[model samples]
Target: MSDVRTPTALPTTTIGPADEPATVGAIGYGAMSIAGTYGAIADADVTAVLDASIEAGANLIDTANVYGDGRSEQLLGRYLAGRRDDVVLASKVGIVNGGGIGKRGIRGDRAYIHEQIDLSLGRLGTDHLDLYYQHRVDPNIPIEETVGALAELVTAGKIRRIGLSEATGDELRRAHAVHPIAAIQSEWSIVSRDIETYVVPTAAELGVTVVAFSPLSRGLFTDSFGPEDVHLGGTRANFPRFQPEHLGANLELAAHFRSLAHRLGTTSEALAIAWVHDRAEQLGARVVSIPGTRSVAHLHANFEALQLELSDETRAEIDGYAARVSGPRASDPNWVSGGREGLI
Candidate 1:
């Protein structure tokens, strides 16, 4: 294991659990990467990464039940045993795996919600989760019914706060009316800015924090991968942005941003994370970025974003570069949710 560097002072943001608030670092650790979604990660390496994250002051660790068919939560459960109190543990439900591997189905019915929470708790080795989210809105079940079930969990002390992922503006409002939402997790990055137009404003108005996942744009914003590196097995392979046809254009856009990062004396990954954080600050909405990685070095590089400050002019340049990106954020139509017409 490598030595963990001293992390810079991270800004604080308060997320709501109705009247209650939980203050956590603005940057968090996304656990999906370690679930072997991209590639296999050693158990020891996963433990080391979690240790380094805690050492670097990233106390919010986010994972989902559907990730690796509950493998992610199980891994966190084993690693977080002694240090559980030191972190804000969050896990999501609603998306259930289909009969075939990689096939998935969403379920937000009252019974499914009741059963999944207990299963998540058991797999996580915790009596209560600091924050719980509905991974995807189920089109069959009403949002009110799902939120009502989540509110029951709070009353039962199964989860401290409630969150919704890929929820639309109207769905968010309706859910909030049933129970206050603590956070809204979505794919928001320099390359993917679809959520900013409406989701950000709705969350800001409802006093809900926006938790930005894939802040690195599925590693497209990083220097490690390029157009030639797109493979057929991993998560990125299925993303439209990473398809061979569109990847070259995306890489061209990324190259421009990479040059800007070089001139700014920072890594492109760090700059990408900083851009998301800075944009949220400018919008006057609380945003926490959970950038996931399997490598300790990459994790450290991401944390460096906390120390890099982007000027207004540089931010504009990055924004302009992002506008040039080609292809949809994800290849699967189901992956693109949270819009008015798409909300479940």
Candidate 2:
């Protein structure tokens, strides 16, 4: 039997500009999985998870326009029809389907950002998003121009605050100069710490919140995960860490991490969350981790991490394990900030 606990409110953290900071739950709900990123989930299950998350005070809902090509936002639109005020709604622009079949790329031009914001608003059924993000930085476009467009949205009442996903230290600095960046979304789990070297310190210096995505390394740290799970299909199939060549070695590292969690009397998922939280404190950065799930039990279980504190020895061991994990964070490192910044 699963150890299910009663849902409780997540502690709050402030995001956005200093004068107009918006308070949101520290543990936000990532809506990527429901977009069939993992697999096809029933509409009813999706509704259940969203309802449960918001009810538990995990009201900072994060989604992207490219997620299922707006299917995810449409689902959230229906769910938010009557409950719009309850969530600190967030969505992204920039990353979209490219010219060719199955091709994907970034689009951060002024006209494109303007067009995408309205489309996202229509899909979300909201006049304005509490927080908006550039899903990925466009190498062809200047970060200043992208942020300038977002700043116009803030002035036009289309978005209250702006954020950037997978942005480098330099990009964040450049973007913030044009407009105060509220948050930065990046992959920051025990297994993916590439952002810590430069992006984190820059964000801390600028007072931008670190919104950690895939904090569990896309279920790699979970108890039920196995090599067979990735073979079943979805985005994980495209991830290098889950490929046959690296799967065994990564799983071995995961096993050792799981054993540590067991000794601490907690699930690996919970410990992973706690580690991100601990790392944030250690680095003097405000962080909010958005871990996605189709199961309400898993969501509640994730909140358990808020109460789990790691000792210095445990944190050091986890870092050691992270260092030994084989493979890059993704198949196309260029698609991520760490890669663009030459970290990977």
Candidate 3:
């Protein structure tokens, strides 16, 4: 589908469990938090985390071309430089040319996408990327044009698989028509359930996996946020929910989730991850979760989430916390994502 140059061999790794656990991972790493935000991470640190993830049994790594203006991929490339056969190396294009603060634009025109594949391959130091996604849908460009171009990548062997991020159901169908979307990367945590109404079902019918990002509610579900936790060195600082006034209210809601977890004999983080997996499955969707973290211990904790299963009554309890509230996801509409009318 895309003529973007690809690596010679495909990585033989999968992110989900063999049985499709109620939650996606047995263990997955979030390289973003450790290295810093979507910006700079030293090659040494990236090398270390890559080692840690494999030791922890994580087979996948998620990153974007705009991360550290491609520094994240560079680090990952260096880490995976020689071990290419061992992991599922996933990266994206479209969200490019961001400022130092991680503010960037999404461009998915065919020509731009072709050039981006080359750039991502160069930064990632791979010929054939296992999975490639449109980091953000460009509103100015049609979804078909963007996905059609991606489909060509699949045909050309540049990208073994294709996915879309921040797309609506209609957009997904338009894209899938041109190519089979292996996944749709969107914020599908317990808090961000908008995809439930349409996107999830649409993806299910197409047999495309829902690659849920931010499954931890940006660490709010960990029962770790405090008044002092505000303004940490990442996008959470600018998020509306992390604002001083909303922090307490949001944490209160998070505490309710935590309380339910306690009654169920699990941590709130595990409960949150389980709920996302179950929610999509109830609707017949296949989910692949990537909750980014710098710590392997936390990665193990997240892996434990796979063992969690709530009955209908308990599912309702968890759903109650999310259904009743509308919290701040972004500080401004501009950075919220997908930048399309009525999509967010």
Best by lDDT: 2
Q: What's model 1's overall lDDT?
A: 0.83
TM-score of each: 0.93, 0.95, 0.85
lDDT of 3 by residue, 143-215 (tens): 8899889878878889877878878878888888876777788877777777777788888887777888889
lDDT of each: 0.83, 0.89, 0.70
| Candidate 2 residue pairs that clash | none
Count of clashing residue pairs in every prediction: 0, 0, 13
RMSD over all Cα atoms, model 1: 4.0
Which candidate leads in TM-score?
2
lDDT of 2 by residue, 38-102 (tens): 87889999999998998877889999998888999999999899889999999999877774212
- Those runs of model 2 whose alpha carbons end farther than 4 Å from true positions after fitting are 1-9, 99-102
In model 2, how large is the Cα lDDT of residue 80? 91
Q: Give the TM-score of candidate 1.
A: 0.93
Q: Model 1 off-target regions past 4 Å?
A: 1-7, 99-103, 338-344
Error of 3 at 163 (Å): 0.7
